[model samples]
Target: MGGPSENPELWAFLESLHLGETLSGTITAIERFGVFVALDDGPNHPVFPGVGFISIPELSWRRFEAASDVVQVGQRVSCEFLQLDTWNLEARLSLRATQPDPFQAFADRNAVGQKLRGHVTKLVPFGVFVQVANGIEGLIHLQELTWTPLKAPSDVVQVGDEVTVVVTQIDRELRRLVLSRRQASPDHL
Candidate 1:
């Protein structure tokens, strides 16, 4: 209904590739959910050029405002094979896996207990999320929003507030960086 449907020869080709193998393709379409890739060396699907497909998180290592920021429809990309979406018969791929992670760039230059300034990106019931680095965020827990006890996170910080926070912990495995505004700010109350 969309691009093309599965055929016998195409099915045989798809069966030949193994997971984690590197493949080349052209970005044929970009949807809100992900980018569809037309493989240079692979067969086409009946519905899409999805011999390869890259999800939003798998598009790039940097924080991009949108998909167009990273690639265009005709752009070529070399991606690692993630898996085959059997239900849809699309090739699941990762573009970022081909390059270095920008989060590592932030980690390399920063450490725990260090004071850094960032803008509050979001305020939730649990904490304030701050963009300390491009695509990297640190959480200032509700209790850490101020030295004194607060009723809610909003009582201390609002969205888009430029705040200084101290790095409390960095969990690389989970890609989490914890921050404390209370530790960085002197108690005036």
Candidate 2:
């Protein structure tokens, strides 16, 4: 065990580990594995001084489909440390874990009956996956794609097509967002 004053560098790092410490760092690189960031200079380097790994679950605001989506070769980001494995020299950082869930933000902005515009990302026999936001996705079921009976969602909407939709239900517990394009344009029904 290291005493605080005896090791100023270690002491500073431990002090900064206190809950709610906000850190800003520059993304040094974005690999298929995860994003690497170098802590802004002071005492603690955002990159963990001598350590080299920052877990993928920490990037803020968006759920990265892949590491590249959330960060590029060079980007600046503010993150909160979730945990540090000093023994292994690993630090877990998070952008989403520290902030309020953005789904709640969407739910707050739009109600069950509110209309929204989204782009269709995929078409399945069961429904279409529309990307409402980078991390947020809403499902438009085949039945909800249109008021009229349809055998497939592709018949009504194709991938990359933008369409208006109405939120029919939001399952916050399950993080499921249910939307209906038919309800928004009932006249077309």
Candidate 3:
């Protein structure tokens, strides 16, 4: 776990790797935390089932219920080499890197003030999440929910309700979309 710099052989192996490099491997194990992969030409993990490790968030950009929803044992996969986990003596890989980011795609095709029709997916104290595009959910903050002040998003909309919204702000770097329902309403205009 602590020998990458201390161990010359491991250091050389790590140096040979280039970030963002594509690596092919077979999924060896899937646990609650992550998935392990035996890279076709990678080094031994020493303690783990495989030398490559993929954290749950790195598995995909889309929201999923479980790791099994995205991958399975013995499944072959191609992932981008993220970095070496010196603490675990394993290479961190990212399956999401192998796929196009839906957030980025959504931002590219849309702009602020653009009106979009989406279904309310979730409600919270602060805001509501609406699926504005495939795999893209934007937050409509409490203040943006209606022209009239409301204590909670539930007062304005509930999950499964179809609503029209206007893109008020888009944070590309943060992968966030701020929406406003009041602005999109014909009565408000």
Candidate 4:
């Protein structure tokens, strides 16, 4: 009954929202790709059920098998404005932006050659990605997986394995963390 169509003042207010604005809302809907929030004291969206929207990756810093792990319908949340999607004509918001960046946090607390332990999250042909912290993942390149020449990362460790590693590089601009498992264990060689 109440929406941008019904309230011109709300439409104008929503349209006036600038980038980087913080807004509070109730999660009205959840989709596989994103979450929709009906902003408090705001008008309904012209197309979406809510005026504020958050994409899957923007849901949280930590990886989860399901969106419900990050947010649920009817939950209250605050999000940072990302952009004004001209195509969909909706506000692209980032829920994660409101939260701390685990990647940056890890880097600030760690450095190259520092030893750390983490769980193997994913194993690719090139390397294995390890979860160094809540949402921070570091890659152990195939060459760094072992001191000896290895065929693949899987040969050294499987996914879900807990492994010790040394930080090799931290590219904050690119948000990348390179790690070395071989350097972490010299006695094993």
lDDT of each: 0.84, 0.71, 0.89, 0.85
**Which residue pairs in candidate 4 have backbone atoms (N, alpha carbon, C) closer than 3 angstroms, thus clashing?**
none
Where model 1 places Cα greater than 4 Å from the true spot, the runs are: 1-6, 62-69
Model 4 C-alpha lDDT per residue in residues 1-189, reported as the tens digit of each score: 355556576557657988899989999999998999898867776668887779998998777887888898999999998886644556788999998887788889998989999999998999999998878889988888887988887777888999999999999888899999989987774
- Among the numbered candidates, top TM-score falls to 3
Clashes of each: 4, 5, 0, 0
lDDT of candidate 2 over 101-131, digit per residue (tens): 8887877777788888899988988999888
| lDDT at residue 124 of model 2 (Cα atoms) | 84
| The best candidate in terms of lDDT | 3
Worst window of 10 by summed lDDT in candidate 3: 4-13
Error in Å for residue 29 of model 3: 1.7
Error of 1 at 41 (Å): 1.2
Sorted by TM-score (best first), the order is 3, 4, 1, 2
Least well predicted 10-residue stretch by lDDT in candidate 4: 1-10
Higher lDDT: candidate 1 or 4? Answer: 4
Prediction 2 global C-alpha lDDT: 0.71
Task: State how far residue 168 of model 3 sits from its true place (Å).
Answer: 0.4
- With a 3 Å backbone cut-off (N, CA, C), the pairs that clash in candidate 3 are none
Task: Flag the better candidate by TM-score, 1 or 4.
Answer: 4
